[model samples]
Target: MPSETPYARLTPDLVLDAITACGLWPDGRLLALNSYENRVWQVGLEEARPVIAKFYRPGRWSDAAILEEHAFALELAAAELPVVAPMVFAERTLLHHDGFRYALSPRHGGRAPSLESADQLEWLGRLIARMHSVGARAAFAHRGNVDRDTLIAQPVRSVLASSLFPSSLHDRYRHVVGRIDRLVAARLEAVGPVRRLRLHGDCHPGNVLWTDAGPHFVDLDDARMGPAVQDLWMLAHDERAMEALLEGYASMRDFDHAELALIPALRAMRQVHYAGWIAARWHDPAFPAAFPFAAEPRWWEQHIIDLHEQADELE
Candidate 1:
């Protein structure tokens, strides 16, 4: 059975009330509600601006993850970096009425880049470096000795164990997975311990926007202290994108060869991670078919296969 709409339980009057309670404009009509995860409306009250109302599911992510995102948004804003600034109505108590958390942010006035533009990529590099300088420090001010073995092993093995790929791409994907597995194993043997750093975690093109201001980053739910390369892996193999992102980052920070090598591994890992996430939500009613990969099973399957193949090629 299809799950109820995110706002199914919420009436127009109640939604208005929620909007009012949150201190956002309550008069504007809800323009769109996607797969029940988030609601977007044009707020005429705020000079006809667009603002998004994001609703959090209970079990999808941890409270720590939410808090971490909150920290990232505020810290980036403080640094004067171009990012979506989220406002929490009640701080720690975002959800007083429902069993979900809520946040409101200005709708970034741009679309996800349909084509890779060098200018945009360059901007991305500069922006990411700035973000890292300011945001990285705060997340790890109080840090822990996060184990590498588990981080690498769990995600990789989970993909293999769960059989996330469709049967059609089994051969192609198997070769790729095998190659990545070998490379990961070799890295473990050679390096012994994996290095750690603060990361945006999900730095995909979908999460980054090209607005009038420049490239603006939106989602930070996956923000955490982990291998820095882990963040790069989220981006697809758009060389222009990588060139722009890396060159921009290099301008501010220095990354060694080891970190560069880890890029391929992290990319492969991220592909597996995302593919698994999609597969898990395949049956979810609330999961919107907003993503390109949603209706394109063959594309997703091939992506996983290609990632592993690239891993093999790297080895």
Candidate 2:
């Protein structure tokens, strides 16, 4: 068996073999996709077009949790929303081969959605509202929520434990993060208890692919239970953009104006969580290669400044 850091063992040959084991004929053409947490490949089929194979990051998510994400994507697809769901094989979406768990999905291609366009933003808003409508129907049994514990507290713990975090900056990092933590907590308390529902948890524009047919959502790996605004804030860049999104969202479902207040708090949490994410994954070669800037002391200095800025925003 491979160690926890198994990507070293997941060579091109192993990836193709995994596909062949799943009854698909690989044509020996494999393109590594843009993914860090999981190893994703664009593999050409024997006689058919290409498909995407996503190998789950070992120890990152349990089987039940991965299935919960798959089920949620399937649910969104069932509603006719343009979401890329895992392709089931032999009555199962989660398949195992060579000590790794993976799933296959048809390759859906499109450029990034134009967040600058009001019309496009509105369209995305409606889609998100519809997704939230279905998302509100039920809760995930094995999946977790997007909250302080998952995004902030846990990440703080991870960074502190990680050797990647510079010992020289330890006190500075702790002080800034501690202030941001208190500020975030106070902001959340000020917002009070807002509605929580299943969300696309990481709804950045990069996840949305825009084609003539419209936007298709990809990568539900970060999906979790959170406020509906968690999905919307990432899409809106300014007040006008947000207004357009809410306009479209209001057309489908009632928009809770109160959720807007949670955006800054969410942003702060994401900032903290992102640093932690890089720290936790620094052991993985991909992380350091992709985020070379994170290794510099100046980066940590700037990060401290950013955290302080976020604290000011919260205040």
How accurate locally, in lDDT, is each candidate? 0.60, 0.91
User: Which residue runs of candidate 1 sit more than 4 Å off their true CA positions?
Assistant: 1-14, 33-48, 90-93, 113-116, 140-179, 188-195, 232-241, 288-311
lDDT of 2 at 18: 89
Q: What tens digits encode model 1's per-residue C-alpha lDDT throughout 1-315?
A: 123344455445555565677666655566654333344443334545666666665465566666666777787888888778776554643444454466677776667854366666666667777776775575554322223333434544444444344556566666665666678667646654555666676677778777665668876666667655555545636666666667767788764436666665555555565555555444444444554454565775667657757676557
In candidate 2, stretches whose alpha carbon ends up further than 4 angstroms from where it belongs are: 1-4
Candidate 1: Cα lDDT at 143: 29
Superposing all C-alpha atoms, what RMSD in Å does each candidate have to the true structure? 4.8, 1.1
